[model samples]
Target: MHEFQLPDMTCGHCAGVVGQTLHLADPACKFQVDLPARKVTVQSDEDRAVLAEALADAGYPPA
Candidate 1:
C-alpha cells in the first residue's frame, strides 16, 4: 500500500478526479481517499514512483 498526502485536495471533486485518474492508470488497483485528512491510500502492484507520477500528471501531486 502507498500513502500520499495531497495538500491541494480540498473537496469531493478533487478526490473524485484523483480517484478516476488513478483508476485509469491501473484499473485493478484499490484505493481510499480521505478528503478531510488530505490523504490517499492506494494498494497496487505498480511501482510507487509510477503511481506518484500518474497522480502528479493528473494534477494532484503528493505533498
Candidate 2:
C-alpha cells in the first residue's frame, strides 16, 4: 500500500478529486481517503512516485 498525507485535502470535494486522480493514475488501484486526517491510502501495483506525481498534478501535493 502507498500512503500520502495531503494537507490540502480538506473536504469531500477534495477527496473526490484525489480519488479521480488516483483512478487516472491507476484504474485498478483501490483506495481509502480520510478527509479528517488529510490522508490517502492506496493499494495498487503502480509505482509510488507515479501516484505521488499524479496527486500533485491534481493540486493535492502530499506532504
Candidate 3:
C-alpha cells in the first residue's frame, strides 16, 4: 500500500478529483481518503513514483 499526505485536499471536490485521477491511471487501484486527516492510502500494482507523478499532474502533489 502507498500512503500520501495531501495537505491541500480540504473538500469533497478535491477528494473526488484525486480519486478519479488515480482510478484513470490504474483501474484496479484501491484507496482510502481521509478528509479530516488530509491523507490518502492506496493499494495498487503501479509504482510509487508513477502514482505520485499522476497525483502531481492532477494538482494534488503529496506533501
Q: Tell me the alpha-carbon RMSD of every candidate.
A: 0.6, 0.4, 0.6
- lDDT by residue (1-63, candidate 1, tens digit) is 999999989999999999998898889999999999999999999888988999999899999
Q: Rate the local accuracy (lDDT) of all candidates.
A: 0.93, 0.96, 0.94
How would you encode candidate 3's per-residue C-alpha lDDT over 1-63 as one tens digit per residue? 999999989999999999998898899999999999999999999998999999999999999
For candidate 2, report its TM-score.
0.98
User: Best TM-score goes to which candidate?
Assistant: 2
Tell me which of candidates 1 and 2 scores higher on lDDT.
Answer: 2
- Arranged by lDDT with the best first, the candidates are 2, 3, 1
TM-score (all chains, Cα) for each model: 0.95, 0.98, 0.96
Worst 10 residues of 1 by lDDT: 17-26
What is model 2's C-alpha RMSD?
0.4
Tell me model 3's lDDT, rounded to 2 decimals. Answer: 0.94
**lDDT score of residue 9 within candidate 1:** 92
